[model samples]
Structures are given as structure tokens and as C-alpha cells.
Target: MNAELVEQYRLLHERRPDYGSGASHVERIAAIIERRGVRSVLDFGCGKGALVERLRARFPEVVVDGYDPAIRGRERIPLERYQMGYEMVIANDVLEHLDAEGYGEDLLEMGRLEPRWLFFNISCRPAVNVLPNGVNCHTLVRRPEWWREVLLACFPGFIEHGSEWNERSKGWMLAMTRPLELEGRRVAIVGNAPQAMGNREDVDGFDCVVRFNNFVVGDGYEAVGTRTDVLAIPACNRAVITPRLKRFTEGVSYVLDLATAGCVQAKANHGKIRQLLPHATIV
Candidate 1:
């Protein structure tokens, strides 16, 4: 957030009380609260804190807090702590007003708070009001696709539950859930530890089984079951790993190469791996 831009917004909020109001997203956010059973909600970039009062009135059981750099009380919370344990975080009609350079940083900061869900309402078109400096209020107006890329980069593995472009507001409303595809399922991430020596029945009973790099299962079958639904392996040294992989290719459907960070050899290794494990998908 730019200091000068924040000062301009602060002045605007004082002059026009309805300038940063987030009443438009009240119903949308309230629906999430009711559906997800969210105990607490932190309204990121809340203007005038109007949404705070409205949400509390609607869902008295849910704790709602607002944070805005331009707002006096709200400004202090974001600066003091990054690990706010809110179940849901909402930013409505707020990203457009911020500087383009600082947008990623702001999104990353919001992610650091670690909310279970993130709700974004971004205006892709120009704002109705102008700034104190004789400029459009919507400083960074980009298409919905551009905004989606930014949000996805910050919150990886978060599945998009709902998304739609609202012609009425000339913006996009997106609801994303963190830790994708794990809800209401029995998932067992079996590790290659000595403690996992006598739990084959319990391990294989899970709906999904995830195992890490180079897990053992021949003589050690009793310890770590024969089920390898999802195998996560390091991308390095495929030549050494191929022999072991050939031995345990059965029931292994997906192989996640985790050490592929700037390693050019990892992409080349994927082809060799595909031939070795014909049944499994190499990622």
C-alpha cells in the first residue's frame, strides 16, 4: 500500500462516507458464513467498516472484523499481526483502488494470515469516483483473467468453489477454498517411518493413500501397505530412482515430482518416467 495513495483515500472517506462502503458484498459473504460455518471473518480492505456492522447484525454468532489501511482502527490490525486465524477473509471492490506494483504484495500479505477461505470482489472497470489528485479511483483496472492469475499465484492449491463476472458491478466475484479436494474424504498420507510397520489394513482402508519419495513395500508390506494411489517423489536423480520405481509401480496412479525447482533435468526425466511407469501419470 502506498502512503500517499492511502492518505488520498483517507481524505476521500472523510469527505464522502459512502466512498469505500462494501455493502454490495454483504449478502455474498454472509452466504459463505452460513454455509461454511465460519466462526470468524476478517474483511480485508474494508471501507468505513460498514460491512462489519451489517454482517454482525445478519450473523450474530459469527465474529466479524474489518481491516483497511485508510481506516483508522482497521489500519492498526494488519500492521500488528499477519497470523490472524480467521476462517474467512473478504476483499470487495478494494484491489482496483490499490497500486499495481503493490497488488501482489498485498495479496501475499493476506495469504500469510492463513484463512480457510478467500473471497474477492474485484472491479475490472473504472470507478465511479475520482481521486483527490484528479485521477480515476480505480488505479489498477485489469481483466478478470489477469486478476485470476495473481490470486492463484498467491493461494496455490486453493480450489475455486464459485466464480462469475458480474455485469452489474463490472467486476468479478470469486470464492476459493484452501487445500483443494480434501473435504469429506478419508485421506491417509502414509509416511516411510518405522512406526508405520504394522498398519497395512488401517492404511489401505482409507479412500485415498498418499506416500512420499521412495517408499518401501516388499518385505515391509505390513508396515506400509501396497496401496500407492498418490506417490510424491523428488525430481532429482531419476537414474538411481528408476530401479526402485519399477519394483513398486503397481497401484501407483500419480507421481508428483517435488524437487523440480529450476532443475532443467526434471522435465527431461518426466519422459523416461512415463515409459517406466506406464500406468501412472507423472506430474
Candidate 2:
């Protein structure tokens, strides 16, 4: 922890300690926890323990804990309490308080908590609140992209939910979760076009080639290459599913678009197509 930054926060807390009255912030986080099925949560830099209390009251089953270095008494708790990890780690309006010099270290420390999902509500703009020295309480104010880059560097494996501006909070809330690695090694989406013919070598190089509905292969084998890893069938083309098309799907993985799966299943050649690719994954 940066001593100087800590002192800045301590001074800021003296002036404006409470997070103010509003269940919107707490409710949003609660909704995420329920949606993600997060059983445990650690609210880092939880000011006044408002969110901690709200989460506890809202979700009795979930194990909710909070720690804030700046706040005193019950609001401030030891970090050692959550050494193992939590299902989700929330750092709402906390990162901006730290100095730019110690920002990376602060993020690294948060990463060490080893949460499956990280919900970061970062304030990109300057804060209305200020420290005793008249300096803005948000010391390390940065754009959402800058925060995204830093977060990704600290936690590489987590899949980022695109940054969205929240009008109510006037900040960017970034949600990242551990992704399902169902898609194998390398994936190249092959579009059905003339350009795809010229890009055969590039397409063939990928571990999986995702081709769209009724894609031609035999006629343009030399140009398009002979590797069909996954075939995507769109519902609009279900009427055109012929015997030749069923044969075209031989020995290839199938990616059925749910909207079109019902239509595709209704086709005469659907049985043969199903027989060819016994296990088809729906997208």
C-alpha cells in the first residue's frame, strides 16, 4: 500500500465518508451476482460498508465481505479475512483514489484475491469530492480504454464485457468473467465470398474453419482448400437444403443457428445431415 495515497484517502474520508443513500448501485451489483451465480463476493475499498450491508441484506445465502484501508472502525477490515478467494471481486469507485505511480501495484494486489469475476466501476472523469489539500479525491483519473488495458494486463485470462457508460453513476462499469474454453485453439470464420477463395491458405492454416450455410467446396477446392472444420447453417437457407448439400456436410462439425435449427430439422435432407454430423453445437 502507498502510504502517501493512504493518507490522501484518510483525509478524503474525513470530509466525505458515506457513499450517499441509493440502492441503485447495490441493486445493480446484486443483480450481477445472481445472474453470474456468484456465491461469494469481496468488495474491495468498500467505503462506509454500505454495499457490504446491502449485499448481505439482499442476498442472505451469499458470503459477502468488505475491506477499506481508509475507513475506520467497522467500515475498515483486515485484508487477511479473504485470503482464499471470492466468486466475484467488486472494486466500485476505488481505483481512481490511488495515485498513478501505485496504480499497477494496487491492481496486482486485487488480482491476487483470485476472483472468478471482476466487476470494476471506474470513474474516468474528475471527482467532485476532494482531499484536504484541495486535490481531487480521484487521483488516478483515466479513460475506460486505459483502465481496460491495465486490467487485461493484470488478469489476462478473464473475458471482458465491453465497457459501457452509466449515466446514473457517471462512470464506466467493466465486467469480466472467466470464459468457457469450448472453442478449440485457433478459429477462422470463413465467409462465403469470392475473397475467401484467394484466402485458402490462411483459412486452412487455422485449427477450425467456420463456414456459412450452403458453402461451396468441391468446385473451388484449389482456391478455398478442402478443410471444413465447422459448418454454420442459417435458417433462411433451409428451403435450399438438397441431397448435395447433405453430402457436402460429411465429416465436418456443425454449428446450427437456433433460429434456423427448427427450419433445418424440418427439411427432407435434415436426417442425412444429422447422421453426417452426429454432434452439432448450437450457437
Candidate 3:
């Protein structure tokens, strides 16, 4: 970001309480965190740290840090943390505000922090606000393909996501992750039934153990086992959304919501389930 643009945003944020909003992207971000099994996150260009605050609230177990040159509290980028890197790094509605000449360096910085994954939401249209110098806030506005080329150049094999330029939003989103290998791993899908009990030793011996919604092993540890690598929930069913799911995530590496299961309202069901289970990964 340019020095003048940074000052302009700082002044704007100080004056307008709603100038740098991030709550709206929490659900989508949460889903990404769950899908990627991201334990630590760096919120690059985190204006006012709203997204960081919300992320901490939703995923208390996950570590979330924020940075932005304009924001007072989030102005300083932790040099040590950046060197350590993060499981996931997110930049929402922040890249477009950068000066075109310098945004590439900022993108490179984000890539450095993302050893595992990088999530981005970039605007491809002009912003409503103008700086004191009469220049639009979104100076680096460009189409999705342009952004794709930039990302590919920085991080090869990055993938584009569901986001597209909308009349109202005017931006696109992309997500990328390092390749994973799980072909030879032993995986056990345990159901919430009495029949799946009494094999605790065998279940725990697997490389990965998966369970279904509302699975209980309180006193039945000898039966169901305590280890849980993944949790699968029925996204279309409202009854399945419960607080118990939160307790299961401590040892769980992934939480999968069967959002695409054959249903009349699959898309709507997915959205509703995501809102209900904000910590679950919809598939």
C-alpha cells in the first residue's frame, strides 16, 4: 500500500466505525479453516482486526493473528511470527486497495506466510470511496484471470474458488493448498451405533478415525474409542446441529458436512448448515 493511501485508510477507519468491515466473511473463512485443518492463521491486511476477532471466537482452538499498516493496533507485522509461517493466510477485500506497482511484493509476503494454504478475496472493480488526492481506493482493480496469473506466478498450481464478480460485491475469491498424500493411510469411519463398539483398540490403531454426528463415547470408550480424526455431519438436517460437535474437534483433524448429499435444496441446505455449524467444512 502507498503511504498516502495508508494514511487515508487510517483516517477513514478512525472516523467511520463501519469503514473496514470483516464480519460478513467469517462463515466462508471458517469453512476454509475447517477444510484445510488450519490451526494457525495470519490475517494479512486485517483492517481493524475484525476478522481476527471473529475467527478467534469461532475457532477458539485455532491461532489467529492480524496485520495492517493503516490500523493502529494491527499496524506492526510480527517479524518472528512471519518467519515461523502459518497454516493459512487470508486477505479479504484488501489486495485491491494496494498500488499496482507494489501489490506484487505484498502478495509475495502473503505467500511466504502460507506454507500450507492461502485464501484471498480481491475486488476487480473501482471502489466507492476516493482518496484526498481524488484517486479511487481500489487502485489495483483487475479481472479474476489477471489475479489468477499473478497468483500462479507467485505460487504455482493455486486454485480459483466459488467467488465471482457480482453486481453488488464486485470481487472474486481464490484458495490454494499444498498437495497432500493420504492414499496408503488406514481410515476408519465409525458410526454412532452400538454395533461399532467394543473395538476401541482396533479403532484407535488406524491412521485416521472418522465419526458421525452426535457420536458418544463417554463411558463407552472401550467400545467406540476416543480418537477422532474426522467428524461427518448431515448438513441438511437441523436436528444434527448441536454443541456436542464442538467437543469432538479437539482431536479431530477435519469436520465434514455432507452438504452435497442428494437433496432438493442442496445449496440452501449447505448455507443454512454452514451458519449453524460455523466450524464445519461443507463438501
Candidate 4:
């Protein structure tokens, strides 16, 4: 990683409250709480502390803390003694940055805390903008099933939450899971390539594409010259207006746009997809 580029990310702690290049991922955590109450919350890699502030504001009753390895500025939690146990631990765009080396220690530290749940987005793909050689910010992006397996191994007994391609809008996957299992945890994908999910049920892909602005909003559309085998959000949400409950909505918008784009390379085997989603591929 370029020093200038790392500094750029630091500055983003100002203008880019969304984190991870407009994909802050706070809403997913917020969404998790909607399903279940979290008494303690930790925002790992909590840049600029915006998402941290958001959580403190919304769930004031719940205890919250912020952790980031890159931050050199004054942080809410002292750098050394920052790690503590919590009910919910959030690692929005933090895990992929671990390719920098020594990230395993950080992972073990979090494990020691043994939070009840881990909500985060791992890099599904890397951005060309950062690396002139065609590399991205992340180094360990295999596939969705691979990610699920890794998370389950790291913290077993937790219900697998969800993963969505944050490709066009950015290159990451939005994920969430809890310690105690839920009777039926749902996956709400907003993209077109439902087949990538392997599970034909909850996977949703569509036949159209959605175009957005610089901020990346879901607006107009384009035709699927080929197939619309992806999941879509607009088709399901039924309403255009979504609660701006947090800064991470932009990331959600990007995932939605990717879904509409029908751009996933991996095609889902209908049987395998059925095991994952069991709902039905939308496209």
C-alpha cells in the first residue's frame, strides 16, 4: 500500500465517513440489531468514528467501543488497552486490510474477546484504482462459500448471516452473523446474479441493471443482453425510500447496483444454491 494512498484513506476519515470508499457498512449492523437486541457493540476499524458515533446515538443504551489498527490520530479507545469483550463485534472493512501482515494476531485478539456476533464485509474483489498493477486493497478473496467456512471455523455456533457482492460500487462482501442461532435468519440480496449464491432459494438475481450517480444511488436501468440470473433489491423492497439510518447505506446501494448488473462470474449449481438459500434465485 502506498503511503500517500494510506494517508488518503486517513483523510477519508473526514470526508468519507462511509468508510472503505463509500462502503461504511453501518446499516447492516443496524439491520442486525433490528432482528435482535445487542447490548454491547464494537466497531473494529472504526475510521473517523462516524459509525461509532452513529451506533452510540442510535443504541445509546448499548455499550459501544471503536478499534482500528491504522489510525494514528487521537482515538476514542486508547490504542493499547482498546480490545475488550462485547456482545456484538463489527469489522466492516477491517479484515481485508489484514493482508498487511501480523493481522492474525489481531484476529486472535478479537477471538479472545469472544464477542457474541461478528458483522463485517470481507474483500470479494480488489480495486484497480489503488494498484496500477491491477491489485486491490484485499489479498484473500476466494469466494462466498469460502468466506462462510472461514467465519464459521473462527467462531462456530453463530448463525451465518449474509454476503452480497459489493463489486461495482466497491469490491467487498457485506456479511453478518450472530452467536446464538435464529430460527430463520434471512438473506436480502439486491443484485441480479442470484446464481452466484449457489443456494437457489434466498439468492436473488434479475434481468435488468440499475444506474446511479457519483454517490451511487439506485435509479434508472439497462437491459440484460444475456441473462438476469441475479438478485435485485428494488424488485423486493417495493419502496424507493429507505431509512438513512446510518452512513453505510451507500455500500448497500453499491451492492444493489452490482446485483442489477448481473456481473458475478461464478454460476451457482442449482442444488448447491438451494442448500444455501432454499428460497429461490430471483433472476
Return the TM-score for each candidate structure. 0.63, 0.61, 0.63, 0.50
Candidate with maximal lDDT: 1
Backbone N/Cα/C clashes per model: 1, 0, 1, 28
lDDT by residue for model 2 over 1-283, one digit each (tens)?
4777677777666776464222236766776687557898888888777788889998999989877777676344344655667878888878887777877877877777778888888888888877777787788888887888889888977756435687776699887766433444566666677777676465677665667777787674666655775565655665565345766665453334424445655563454333333343433
Tell me each candidate's RMSD, in Å, in order.
12.3, 13.9, 8.1, 13.2
Residues 25-105, model 1: lDDT tens digits: 677777678755789888888888788889988889887888898988778554334555678889888889888778788
**Candidate 3 residues 1-283, lDDT tens each?**
7687789888878877777875456777788788657799988888877888989998999989999999887886687887788888888888898878888788887776755777788888888887666788788888888888888798764433334455677768776655333456666667776767656567778766767778786574556777876666675542455465566566554445555455665786566434433444557
Model 4, CA-based lDDT: 0.50
Cα displacement (Å) at residue 152, model 2: 0.8
lDDT of each: 0.75, 0.68, 0.73, 0.50
lDDT of 4 by residue, 80-157 (tens): 334556767787766665554455566666666667667767656654334333345464555666666666676654
- Clashing pairs for predicted structure model 2, backbone only: none
Higher-scoring candidate on TM-score, 2 or 3: 3
